[model samples]
Every structure is written in structure tokens, then in C-alpha cells.
Target: MISCSPAEPVVPKEGGGNRERGAAPRWILADFDDTLAPGDSHAGLLRYILRRRIWPLLLLPVIALGGVVYLVPSQRRRGISLIWWAITLGLSPLGWRKLVRAYCHTRPGLFREAHRLLEEEGHRCWVLSASPRALVRAQLALQRPANLPYRTIGSRMHYRLGGLMPRFYCHGQHKLLPEICALDTELALSDSLHDLPLLGLGEQGWLINPTPARLEKARARLPHLMVKNWQL
Candidate 1:
């Protein structure tokens, strides 16, 4: 017969909580347009089309109508923008790619020191934008380091039945829903007050080169956000 002895108490493993926290990947959500580049990519694409193709000139009335539609309400703006895209620049994906490449070439300094710092910190970075996905992807591919792994979520366009269709419009206050549904955001970087919703989701928020009024508004909403100025 074996003699019974006092039971030893169980001890929690050292840094057990740290191990659990480390398992969850860190993600940095960055806005594409002004945050990455000096100007808005959507407006740049529109300008590119207007300068390169004469056909879009004939649709001046349609473009004007779209501009008016954009002012109506935030909910309806995406639809109007999509319609404008289809009418003006959605004729050929190949053509769009070429245009995007040409546009990116002029903006060599698109990827700034902030992006480098984020990457250096071992955080997975992604671009979230109201600009079309194709355009944003093309811009990143052109500007970012080849070895750095990054992804983009933005408005999507699909080619169906010999026409381009707007598949998704990731924008405005609702921009974070589509992105955060799949991944957790550790940090967020943006230049506009429009990204307030997205900035609110991040564990850390960075406002880059925001105007004084916009900065004040952001501070009121997210007082903890880190402010930094970046120039093109």
C-alpha cells in the first residue's frame, strides 16, 4: 500500500498572459490617399481619364450630375461614384492598370517614413481607402518594398457581361465594418477627419498632417490619438 502525501498547489506559468496576447497578430490600418500620397487617388484617376481620353469629355453632363449626386447624402454617394466610374473609366481593366501605373510613377515618394516605422515594428500593415482597390493596389505595388507583405481593402470593381460593375464601396463612416469584421486593428493612421470611425477602432491612432480644425475635431473624438505631420 502506498502512503498518501500532501498535494502540491498548481502554479500559473510565467508570462502566460503575454503568450496569449502575442498569439493575436498586430495589424496597422492606414488610409491610402493623403496618408500615403500627397493627393487623392480617386480624384487623380478621374483627372487621368479626363486628360488621356476624349470620350469622357462627351459625358460632361453625366459627370456633373454625379458631382451633384455626391453632395446629396453620404449613403447615396457611393452609388453615384460607381456609376460615374463605370461610365468614364471602367471600359477596360487593362487600360485602367496602365493609367494607374503611369499615375504612380509620378508619385515616387508615396511611401513615407511612417510606413517604414510601422513595418520596422513588426506590425502587419494594410491600406483602407475609399479609392478603387485596383488603383490603390497598383500604387502600393509601385511604391512599397517588394519584400514587405501588405494588403489593401478598398472599393472594388468587377467585370461582368462585358462591363465593369461596382462590387463594393468601402468608404465614409462605414469603412471599418468590412475590414475589422475579418481582422483586429492594433493601430490606425490617417490624414482626414472622415476616418474618425476607423481611428476609433484602433488600440493606437495616428493622425498625419491634419489641419488645425480637423485635428481639433479628432482630438475631441479621440483624445489619445498620436498626432504627427508628414509632407509630400
Candidate 2:
């Protein structure tokens, strides 16, 4: 609903990916959860927090409430926020990055091809994730080569509402705000239908490990959508 100025654009590096000489660099947007990493970062974050706490059971009611609220389409965002608050209730910002990084180190697996694509300089890849910003960065640092020439944008995990609310949700069509539109998108990669707004942007679309039904729905609108596989 509100307009924002575009972000500082990323200059393309020559000899990147597979582009012909003088060809425009392809712009790519990829999801983090279930796309790059097989596990959901938010779920992993909550699990990490719960295991460290003395009595995680105290947080159960709030978490349950969030799950119930999340079933309602209109209240899903707030529901997720409430669940985040519950997990982060007593956790301070201090040493959180270390914790997040530590958690990433223990993650099961990342899709090698997806991670490789992000590292490629031929195309400009932007990791547009719904996961918390710091969490995504921590995960990326463990896997991504340093200065591989890519960008990451993620949800703002503000501590407001007792850590329940976000400054920017960065989910669904909200990912297509002015700041993102500033970049030229030639491809999109995601697992969820919620990202149809972003997937619609480019000529090429990739469905990361989608179910048959979901793939069918996506192909209905994006005939160019190609399936990318990552097995658990």
C-alpha cells in the first residue's frame, strides 16, 4: 500500500553464468525455506530456542494459540507473529547471531544446485525469504562463499509486540514492493504458491520440490515453470 524508493541496484559482473556477450544479466529471486534449505528456518529457530529454555512447556499455550489463529486466512500473519513471540520471549538479542549460526551448522542439508546458482556471477541472485533476516544471514554465511556476488532480503524480526510483530513481513505479494521491482527479474525460484506475485515477474520460473497439485497450479499461470528437485 505504501511506496518506497528502489534499493541501490547491483551492477552486473561480466562473464557471469551463461549469458552471451552484451546480453542483459538475468535477475533471479529465490526463496530460502524448502528451496535452498530443506528445512523451514522458522521452525528450526523455534526448535533451537525451545531446546535451550528451562521450561518450554510454558510457551506451549501461546504456540498452540498461534497455530489455531494461523488457520484463518486473514489472521495468518498475526498468528505467525504470535508464535515467533512465544519462541523469542526470553531470548535476548545478545549472542543470538552465534546461536543462529550454530543452528545453521547443524542443518540437515541444502540443495546444492540452488546454492550453486546463488553463487553464480552470471546472473544476479536475490534470496528473498520470509525467514527472519539475521537467521537467513547466519545460514547463508555457513554455506555461501564469501563475496560470491548475491543479495539477501528477508522479514524484519522486530521485537515489538513482545517480539510478535514484524517491521516488514516480506511475505507473499509484499515481496514485490517498489524496492524489489527496481531490479529486473528474469527468473523466480520458490516452492510455495504464495509467491505467485514474484514468480509472475520473469520469463522463467522454477518450482522447488513442489507437489504435483502445486506444480500444476503454478504451470497454469506460468507455462515456463520448470521443476527443480531436492530430495530429503
Which predicted model would earn the best lDDT?
A: 2
Q: What is the C-alpha lDDT of each candidate?
A: 0.66, 0.72
Candidate 2 runs further than 4 Å off = 1-24, 147-149, 161-165
The residue-by-residue lDDT of candidate 2 on 114-231, one tens digit each, is 6567666514878888888787877777776473327788888777654545667777767877756665567778898877667766556788888999999887766677898976
User: Candidate 2: global Cα-lDDT?
Assistant: 0.72
lDDT score for residue 146 of model 2: 73
The list of candidate 1 runs beyond 4 A from truth reads 1-22, 76-83, 86-90, 121-123, 159-165, 178-182
**How high is the lDDT of residue 70 in model 2?**
81
For every model shown, the clashing-pair count is 0, 2
lDDT of 1 by residue, 25-100 (tens): 7677788788867788777777776778777677677677767677665545544564456455546877767777
Error of 2 at 189 (Å): 0.7
The TM-score that candidate 2 achieves is: 0.82
Q: What range of 10 consecutive residues in model 1 has the weakest lDDT sum?
A: 1-10
